[model samples]
Target: MPAEGVELTPSPQILTKTEILRLANLFLSSGVTKIRLTGGEPTVRKDIEDICLELSNLKGLRTLSMTTNGIALTRKLPRLKDCGLTSLNISVDTLVPAKFEFMTKRRGHEKVMNSINAAIDLGFNPVKVNCVVMRGFNDDGICDFVELTRDKPIDIRFIEFMPFDGNVWNVKKLVPYSEMLDTVMKQFPSLKRDQDHPTDTAKNFTIDGHEGRVSFITSMTEHFCAGCNRLRLLADGNFKVCLFGPSELAVSMAEYGSGSCLLLD
Candidate 1:
């Protein structure tokens, strides 16, 4: 995950098309199938379309997705789709503007909603809306988020808030998996879990006769560290094994001789 509150570097030292292509080629050759671009906010990067295009063209690559705050997706979804973006996971905490601004420290709730609509309009399948549920922060909007996507094809996932970024994470602030299910079940009495694609972090549920689905990501109450398959490469080239894992390996293009590795046992 991108570190929040870091000073933005205003230089033109961003990754070039050729460098991105090289990195994509290396990962594809290493038997990696899916690639996701994430950051403090990836959409803010200049010329992101070019980077997407290069990755989409890589051989043997099965999936190309992105995780964004959705602040800039509305204006770039079409172009991004053309460049082979298959799916999107947008981070939207609350439907209420005041709470959203307070959580993200930015005013982009309206823009995020527009981006979700734009992504759907662009034919992105299963557009996912990621909502981090904190007990007293935005838990009140869980039902609202679920209702918002009931008629659409989007998937709204309610992620249990975890301790990170040195924030004062109170265990009581976590909306437990049981409570989340209870909330949705009350609204849709016929809601059932989807066992087709089992993901440990999120308990997937779908409403009867609805096109969308809702999920509860109980990361703290339930961990899926064993089956986790992801390696985060920081913008400056640090390798992060797990989101909550402490072990990390920092390398450069020169030291490692041009390849990323899984350092975790």
Candidate 2:
């Protein structure tokens, strides 16, 4: 979240539940098996459970996951799981409460922690915690987050800070994956390589005797563009082929009224 805050798109311009399903079904029919409900914060939507329930039931959709800030996730996770949410990725840049509040411009550290615990309790396999490591920001907390995986079965994903829209993007602030891995190795010399999926962006590892695992998303230093198989559909119905790439197509389901005419034929 930017300090001045982001401009909220008008509600009427945002895609409704039906429109989201239409686009999702189209993608599923086109052989897209995994679907993750990312955001701004997927938990904020009033009809999120309804959306999750319907999307989980869609044929050919193998995964129904969500990436949330975890503010309202604690109470919602049980229902969300019962509604068929298969996976979860919670973003917590800092383990320090003050730093968390400063980074997000909000006071929800306890809530976020509770959400993480709740997800683990609910048995969400590979409960991934996303931590974007910035040099001067939360890079020092890498081991702190890694320690989270000491006993729990959580997967701590330390993501390299990358350039994106809004906020200042400086090379000095970027913490490359190599540096992060070295930092971890210094602490846990017993760190051993773990197998990763062919298309996985994160280079995974596990420490001897630790029940959990850690992975580094080296988006900055080592680009995974070739193996990258991800597309982003914005809340306002804009289609982004890549997170760092330009918008390739724009469709306003609000204007088209969930009609197939707006879809690619």
Candidate 3:
């Protein structure tokens, strides 16, 4: 959020435990096989481990993943892994400690690095590191992030900055997908494009013999709208088929009575 935005209100309207599981189960039959638990900070939830445990038990679900800041993963990841947590996407923008603090206003950069290593050791397939690429900000670390994929099996993803409510988006800060690729290909001439998975949001690649991989999530300059297949559930029980569209067609998960809330195209 920008400094000029309104004060953050405490939303006391999140869904209950039953509602989350119920919602998860409801979609399982509809071919929604993956459920990713996220939050303003999901690890802050006291019941996150239990949530993962329950969702992992859902019969038809193929994957249960999470995207976290990784502040609390050092202690919780082992249990989360045992409870059938499939993978993780950890967010860290800058490699420099000073810049990390300047960007996130937090001092837990080391913890995030620890969590990334810990996930790799614990067998989280392709432990992904998400870097939101901004032109004058953490963009300098693009190659540095890509270097991680050379030896280890971590998948480093360069994400384009996106505009959402309350987020302070600067058009000048945007680094297009082409720029990121050009920068990497210039430094690492051995890198070659990998075969793509149709539903994968990121365009992936790998080096000649590197254990890991790299990707560009080109949501801005080269939008992948034509191949999009996504749905999102908000913290407050409301859900949406599209992440960019204005909030609409909310189903009240607090009280479970539902009709077709989303139109399948």
Candidate 4:
């Protein structure tokens, strides 16, 4: 979050490649089928491609995807794709460059735009665009985002503003799923509906005459927390069982694949 005080960690404590692979193999062997690499920005990791290749080699691993800001994504996409990167979920709030700069407080909208096109150009299947919908902010650009999906196989996903720390969140900024759907439906009245997956966070629909999909994430207005086994790994080698929660529990990769897990189930 830009509003939060951003600082570079000095001598950061993160798991190495061997440890990461160990953890991955452990989880995969224990019924973890899918994996998506996310971060403050996973692209910042110089060894990301190496990490992708090692994990992709696992026979039990079904898919490998990533959520990135797309600012530095173009040059890395082809290599990552070749190494078992199945799909991409790029964050793009608005099509307008000026507004984008305003929201992200960065000067890389053009680069991000090119990155999106690059993913599509490189034949990335179903490229996802994660747009955080904030009312009186980037909400007006909803139709513009939908327009991109007309010719491309992109999935424009509208995520409601979540109450994360340092994000200056408020109920007024929450863009409900119903309202998001209504806004898009006004422009695209005839869209094909997609069946919901058991663990899908997005409510998906496709433009009737277009080649892509659109989805809305309504976590704020609706609760989907029960029985969700979402265990997130933080940047500094900690496990956050619930991402919105304040506390983080320590988890070590040292004993990850030693068959000594607490849950014997």
Candidate 5:
């Protein structure tokens, strides 16, 4: 989070539950089976449970997942799980509490940890933990994250820091996927390669005795654009077709009806 904070979008401008469902249904009908509720911290929404319920109940929607910081997940996960939230990816960049505070500019290290445990306790098998690895920062904690999977069925995913607006992204800070993999292999030479789905973003691996697995989202170094099957919808109903690619092709849900939106491709 930026220290000065970002300008908030007005409530009226953001897509309402009904509008979100309409778009979700439209996408479902178009063969989009998975829908992930990502954020600026999705748990902050007052009607998040309601949103999850409606989305999860949508026909043709196979998964209703979320990517959250996990600050409020401990209290929210049970309700969210009841509402049919299928999967979770909790972002905890570092294991060190002090470094977490420094990186996020907040004090929620314990809360995030609690949230991860809460998800695991609630039968969220193979609960994923997303760690954005930056050189000279939390990159040193790579093995520490891997250790979390020793007994628990967690998927510790190391993501390469990619350039984004206002993130002050630099090449120096970027830790490539190969480098990360090599670092892990040196510590655990017996790490075995795991099969991945054709469209899976992360290349997976598993340790012989560990309950969980490890993977790397090699967006910066190894582009998965060819087999990419992801789409993003902004809060204001704008469709972001690609995460790293240009948004010149962005389409607004307000301007187009369901039929037109589906025909956009």
Candidate 6:
């Protein structure tokens, strides 16, 4: 779950607290144990803390988390933690300031780094960093990113760049999974795979005696089309069943009169 397109529509209408609560209840009734809130940037939402608090009180939801770009966590993390946010996944493409600017089209490397530090200080244990590996771009920064958190508790994951939003995707721009592992292994001889979280997207591995871990997501090079159990709801209320598929289900809130119409049995 990534929060990158939460504010797609002009003056987007955020799902109200009542609607969020109802949706949580519906999922719980269906025996779903985990729920993640994602957006183009979830922390940008005005009442994010309120939504987290409401979802935390749900009966059967055992885990609650969010995926953000780490731009606004400095001010919102404490409140989110108090409301039962146990884990966080932050997106970071490159450590080099210039490359980062080119990748995200934003000049906030310092701000993002500050946010990561603030989240760790605020007790976001086991914080994870997501880096999308693009060939001929930030692929050189893989070792630097791994070294930054090698002795810390952070989990750094290398994601193979994929085509989304109909962007032009090319194999030449993709750094394969084998190449990514080779790059890391050349520097850290003690790294080994961690088998605890088997279903995770990235293949989990750790520096033998260190607290930090590294992973690789082979979405394009190797597809995990099966065993993917997830759903995406756009800010405009369109439900996307597959991130790569063309199928879409659009539910008009105006027709249903409220958020209750989104309930799934």
Please report the candidate that would top TM-score against the real structure. 5
lDDT string, candidate 1, 1-265, tens digits: 3226657654454455676677667766776677788876778778789888888898977788899999888988899989988878999988888887788777888999999889888887688999988888888888888887668988999998888765678888988888988998898898898883432456788888778889887788777665565666666445775688766677664443322222111
Clashing pairs in 5: none
C-alpha TM-scores of all predictions: 0.88, 0.92, 0.91, 0.91, 0.93, 0.87
Model 4 misplacement above 4 A: 252-265
Model 1: how far residue 132 lies from native, Å: 0.1
CA RMSD, predictions in order: 3.9, 4.4, 3.9, 3.9, 3.4, 4.9
Model 3, 1-265: lDDT tens per residue? Answer: 3546555435477766777888788877666777777756778878888888998898787888888998789889999998888978999998888898888876999999999999989988799999999989988899999889878889999999998776778898899988889999999988788888677789999988788899999988877777666667776666665667886557654433332221111
Supply the global lDDT for candidate 5.
0.86
Question: What is the per-residue lDDT of model 2 for residues 1-265, given as tens digits with 9 covering 90 to 100?
Answer: 7787889989998989998899888777666788888878888899999998998899887788888999999998999999999988999999999999888899999999999999989998679999999888899899999898998878999998877777688899998888999999999999988887777878899999888899999888898878777767788878765677755567553332221111111
Deviating ranges (above 4 Å) for candidate 6:
1-7, 10-14, 196-198, 251-265
Candidate 2: global Cα-lDDT?
Answer: 0.84
RMSD of 4: 3.9
**Candidate 2: worst-modelled 10 consecutive residues by lDDT:** 256-265
By TM-score rank, best first, the candidates go: 5, 2, 4, 3, 1, 6
Q: What CA RMSD would candidate 1 show? A: 3.9
lDDT of each: 0.77, 0.84, 0.80, 0.80, 0.86, 0.74
lDDT measured at residue 75 in model 3 versus the true structure, 0 to 100: 86
Off by over 4 Å in 1: 1-4, 8-16, 196-201, 251-265
**What is the C-alpha lDDT profile of model 6 across 187-220, one tens digit per residue?**
9988888784434556888887766788888887
